[model samples]
Target: MPTISGAGFVVTTLNKILAIAGVAIVLGGVALGFRSVSAGGTVCGSAFQPAAGITPMSCDNALNGAGTLVTIVISAGVLCLIAAAAVKVVRDKVNA
Candidate 1:
């Protein structure tokens, strides 16, 4: 049987924490974006005006969907990286 290294354990734990934080940040960003869009408000609190004949939508309304999707993708990527790191740490520790 192989023994686990202290460094490996610590690294695995840190990776888990990072994964959780990444997910939280992504969720929060999406929620805020949706709220801003639904409220027809700008995330920056700036008032937007359309051209003389064109009607303008709020920046949030225009950008939130794509922004949320991008955030979610990034979060998923972080989660995958964390998971991979954790697995590598554990495998290394167990095989050492």
Candidate 2:
């Protein structure tokens, strides 16, 4: 049985954390894109002539909501990346 050293274990754990953060960022991007497209396709206006990609009822609300969601998601993604990097630094210092 090969026993992992302290530095090796710490590095492996850090890599896993970074990988999870990467996945979160990718998923967040995909969600943002999907919501934007879905919101654009919805109707938000009343009897007035809808603009391009605007619907009658759901356009404004959906777009606004999606925008908010995108903001939150992007912020979370950034935080995740920062957290991953910070954790890696912490792990390295502790292992060193």
Candidate 3:
């Protein structure tokens, strides 16, 4: 069996970390999105419109912000996963 050494070991470790982090981040984003939708719906009614006396547009802006944040988090997680895969491919090609 071939053994990983030096930079190869570091790369392998980093790849594993990245993959795990990506999965975690993706899950977190999904959770956050669900929470936001549910909470926003409750607070702003079915259509995300605030009640008559509440501050105008605040709820809408918050919901939009949450959506943007979720998108960014999920995109970052996917990029991390892709980077990890790319690293593995490159490392294998180099070793081969």
Candidate 4:
């Protein structure tokens, strides 16, 4: 029988919260991006072309959005793994 310590529990909980927050932020950003695209709003346009009636977006803009989402998901997953690892470590330590 192992007893969990206060510090370990708190750290694990905080890490889980941070992971959730990161996921939420990523989802929110993606939703905003979809809204922008649907509304014909350019996020990273070259010069905001309204005369030619053609919005110009560099490959970088698409890359940025994808990269951001990927980064967020990775960060969230890492944080969750860290939290799980911390819980395991604490349990092992307490048991030992």
Q: Which rank order by lDDT, best down to worst? A: 3, 2, 1, 4
Clashes within 3 Å, all models in order: 0, 7, 0, 0
User: Could you give candidate 1's per-residue lDDT for residues 1-96 as a string of tens digits?
Assistant: 755479767766776776677677656555544442223433322122222322345344445454555566667757766775777677667666
lDDT of each: 0.55, 0.63, 0.75, 0.53
Candidate 3 lDDT over residue span 10-76, tens digit each: 9999999999999999988877676633344445422223345444465666667677878898999
Error of 3 at 90 (Å): 0.5
Model 4, 1-96: lDDT tens digits are 755588867766765676676567556555544432212343442211122343445344554555566566656656666666676677568657
lDDT (C-alpha) at residue 66 in model 4: 56
- Which candidate leads in lDDT? 3
Per-residue lDDT over 1-96 for candidate 2, one digit per residue giving the tens place of the 0 to 100 score: 856788778777877787687678867665664543344545442222234655436566655666566667777777777777877787669667
Of 1 and 2, the candidate ranking higher by TM-score? 2
Instruction: Order the numbered candidates by TM-score, best leading.
Output: 3, 2, 1, 4
lDDT of 3: 0.75
